[model samples]
Target: MQVRALARGVRMSPQKARLVVDAIRGRAAVEALAFLDTSPKAASEVVAKILRSALANAANNFSLNTDGMVVVTATADKGPTLPRRFRPRARGQAGVIEKKTTHITVVVSNDIEPTRRGYKRKPA
Candidate 1:
């Protein structure tokens, strides 16, 4: 069984958030929460919130026990960027200032095995 939670248009850039998500991947749900709690990065808090949401979903909606759940998939994908702004630089040059955003998703599951890359199927 699996449950997913998404945090869209998060203020942080995808590249930065990816670091935190990668760390928590394939970890038990409780362990992931602990690591996120102690992490200093701004992204950790957002990821942790989403993780908790997933846990609640598993418990309330599906009536599943989340004690042994694992983070099956945790990803941070680039979201739409806001309008670009310009900052005046030396020599009267305008420097482009981009405000990036990201869409984060986390899937927690139990009793499932992740598939391998380049997977091939055999006839039953």
Candidate 2:
């Protein structure tokens, strides 16, 4: 079974978060958490926070085993942008300062029973 959790309105750009999410895709949940812990990117912390939430959802809601779960899917989507601020420039000109946000979602799955291509096998 698969379980997912979403963290919306994260105060970071989607492009930045995507880089962090890529490292953890298709990896075990525990290992992913460890990588996030030592990663130096700015987005690593935010990705770690969301991954933890997803892990909690998998455990508490679906009764999945934490040790057996894998990160099936992780995505960082562009979210709503706040009003752009302006910085004063030469000759009374103003520069646009855009602040981007991201929405992150992670899905974890544990194969309680082995099946071919996620399909249920019928007895012969």
Candidate 3:
């Protein structure tokens, strides 16, 4: 089973969020949480919350074992930009500033297949 969590319009830029997400992909739930905890980036806190939410969704909604689940995929997308204008002291020169936002999605999965045994012909 798979569970997804999303955070929209986060203050961080998509580029920054993507760097944090790249570090935790394909990692176990506990390990990912730990990585996020020690990460120096501000976006890690937001991503951590989303990860925890995803884990809870997987456990509560899908009734999946949390230990077997992993962060299968994580993505950060650009959101709406806030534009602002500021004037400098040079002959009434104005500059445009853009405050970017990001949308992050995390998916956790617990659907590993069990390996088959070769010597299983004893008796029914």
Candidate 4:
């Protein structure tokens, strides 16, 4: 079973968010949360919240074992830029500033064995 959570319009660049997400990919829920808690990057906190949400979703919706779940995929994408204007140096001159935004997604899934079909085992 799998569950996903998203954090949209986060006030961080997608590139920075991607770095944090990469660190936690394939890590178990508890370990990932721990790592995020101590991480020095600002983006870590945002990603951690989304991860926690995903864990809660799994537990509440799927009733899955939290300990057995790992971060299957985590990604960050660029969101709409917020435009701002500012005056710098010369009079009557204006500069445009673009505040970046990011959309982060985290997926948590439990380990499950794949089933094989059309085969029967013989009794010993």
Which of the numbered candidates is closest to the native, going by highest TM-score?
A: 1
Error of 4 at 71 (Å): 0.3
Tens digit per residue, CA lDDT, model 1, 1-124: 7799999999899999999998888777898899999999999999999999999999999999988778888999999888688999999999888899999999988765323321122233
Q: Pick the candidate with the highest lDDT.
A: 1
- Candidate 2 residue runs with Cα over 4 Å from true position: 88-93, 112-124
The CA lDDT of each predicted structure is 0.87, 0.82, 0.83, 0.82
Q: Between the candidate structures 1 and 4, which one is better when assessed by TM-score?
A: 1
Give the lDDT of residue 85 in candidate 2.
Answer: 89
- Candidate 4 stretches with Cα past 4 Å from truth are 87-94, 112-124
**Which portions of model 3 miss their true places by more than 4 Å?**
87-92, 112-124
If scored against the real structure, what TM-score would every candidate get? 0.85, 0.82, 0.83, 0.82
Looking at model 2, residue 99 earns an lDDT score of: 88
Lowest lDDT block of 10, candidate 3: 113-122
Whose TM-score is higher: candidate 1's or candidate 3's?
1
Pull out the clashing pairs in model 3.
none
Model 3: per-residue Cα lDDT over 1-124, one tens digit each: 6789999999888999999998887777788898999999998999999999999998888878898767877899999999866656577877777899999999877664221211112133
